[model samples]
Target: MTASDRIWQAQLRAHWAVLSARRDTAGVATSGLGILVGDEAEILAGVDARGDHHLLVPAGGGALVVEDSQAAYIRIQRCVLTIGGRGRTFVDIVCHRADLSELFDDVISSMLTELATDSREQPAVVCKRVLDEWRELLRRRGGLLGEDALRGLFGELVVLERILAASDTYDLSVWHGPDREPHDFRLLGGDLEVKTLGMAGSMVRVHGIEQLEPPDKGDLHLIVVRLVADHDGLALPDLVERIRPKTNDRRAFAAALARAGYSETDAEHYRDRRFMIAQVAALPIGDDFPRIAPSSLVDTLPDEVSALSYNLDLSLLLPKALTDAAITPLFTKGTLS
Candidate 1:
């Protein structure tokens, strides 16, 4: 086991011990491990008054599917936990056997470490994957993604639809954002980084300076997708279904969706999150583009000053937005150069 595994295991054991001491406690005794969904949501582990070990994974609102564990030692179900005075939904994984508490601790420890590593993924999604890795329970689908992630995905799909309509050779492979690439799309001509904003907001949060940095030999364009929430608009699942048929390769597209923390099983949960694309402006990133790149930061900030992120106000560049005719060459020829 790694050092992180040991730390998590120790914390779980300590929390359990404390719960055991106060068996008459009314509510759950939880120890925060790592983030699960949004900024306020987190993954927790504790022991009930009955002394059962449980792992609480936060989930978005949906019908909880409980697996039949008659032959297994653990029970999995959905529940509402009163955490910090809020009724939050969580996937409760309870170990019924007292003798196997130590083994369960080790498994929980490893799972916590995995969640810490893939901090971007939803905790329930991570939990499902880890459960499969251990092969201790039935394989189940994860819950819906957070609202921010869902909207961001919607924006990316909108851009993807445009790309597919404009290009003949570019397939789903050009979308490298799902694979955690530096940029969202890498076309043969150059690179295109996508950003999404909701409502009338003109500011787009840029993560890391490398996101705006242009390619060495080709041009780099920034595309900002502005969205508005409306009941008349199509939801994320609707857009996914609409775009799924356009792809020549369904298998690769499904894999891409999985990498993006989206599961078809959880589609029903996102039916209410409808959005309409307000505007999509493509701007060629140049030296004067409002950004902080490696070139601009070199010799000024130390190497230790990394993971830099900033907000780029699009209102300034909205006037410079390229027309459809001007942006067509990038798709047809692959690059502006």
Candidate 2:
């Protein structure tokens, strides 16, 4: 576990201790331990009349917790937990089994860490995602991403940073690559497909026919980011942390990062994986561009060929590259589609 994780665990235990002490002394029917987890979100650790331990996470924006969202380790529901005569709605998570309290602490620690990460998502959304991720982790352990995946994610973050810099209204949901969308970013004016290559590499891999296909009504542009590993350059974690503050919705951005298979827990793994940009080329996909799209292959190809993957040599497409000034306009012109 990281130092941050340890601190969160200690804080949770301290809060629980105070609540437990109160439960024993006054014999109160219920007690709450409310404390700030992040800049805006507050957490409440409580002891019920039956001595059941509960953790209440503020459910921002009136987000609801569904009925009986329980697992073997914890029970979850929505309720208004009060302390010091102040009431606030929260997603209440209960650990009835004493033997599972340690496990519960770990879970709460993870949730607090996520909440504290400058997330802009609703508190309920962040809590549920953390719980879901934990459930997946326990079901089958997963390892850190490979070098190629890391580079791809790094390139996407670079572009996202550019987009954020170019516009004031940041909507992280438009970044659909992590969700396995056909395009990496869906902007109002067009859709963008980002490809990351080695500094010396020439070929750009086209994953599917839909990849280069234009949006239903807008244009499509392919962004090629060529990078080289350098000791002086920034690592994945550096870029992530740098961009986190610029985004208005940090939680949503964090969730997008998580979906892309990047996590703070695995930051140590990418410490040495620093990258320097070699070049960034923006090429608008049009009729003249070389690509295999469903529209281009209409009625001519065999039905048996359901999928396609190929490489395009970037050296052959120099004339198509857009200038740096032109690149920013593509992201800035469109509202999030």
Q: Count the backbone clashes (under 3 Å) in each candidate.
A: 1, 2
Candidate 1: stretches off by over 4 Å: 1-143
Q: Per-residue CA lDDT of candidate 1, range 1-337, in tens?
A: 4678767766887788776776556866677765555455777777777788898877765534454354355566677888668888887777877755654675677677887774766666666666555442212235557877787788888878878889888888888877777788888888988888887788888888789989887889888778899899989878887886577654456567767878554566788878888777789888888889876665665778877888888887877887566777776555774
For candidate 2, lDDT tens digit of each residue in 82-178? 5567766778877776655655776777776776676677667777777776655544124687888889999998889888899875467668988
Error of 1 at 163 (Å): 1.2
Superposed model 2: Cα runs more than 4 Å off: 1-142, 334-337
TM-score list, all predictions: 0.57, 0.61
Where's the lowest-lDDT run of ten residues in candidate 2? 25-34
> Which RMSD does model 1 reach against the true structure?
17.2
Compared with the true structure, model 2 gives a TM-score of 0.61
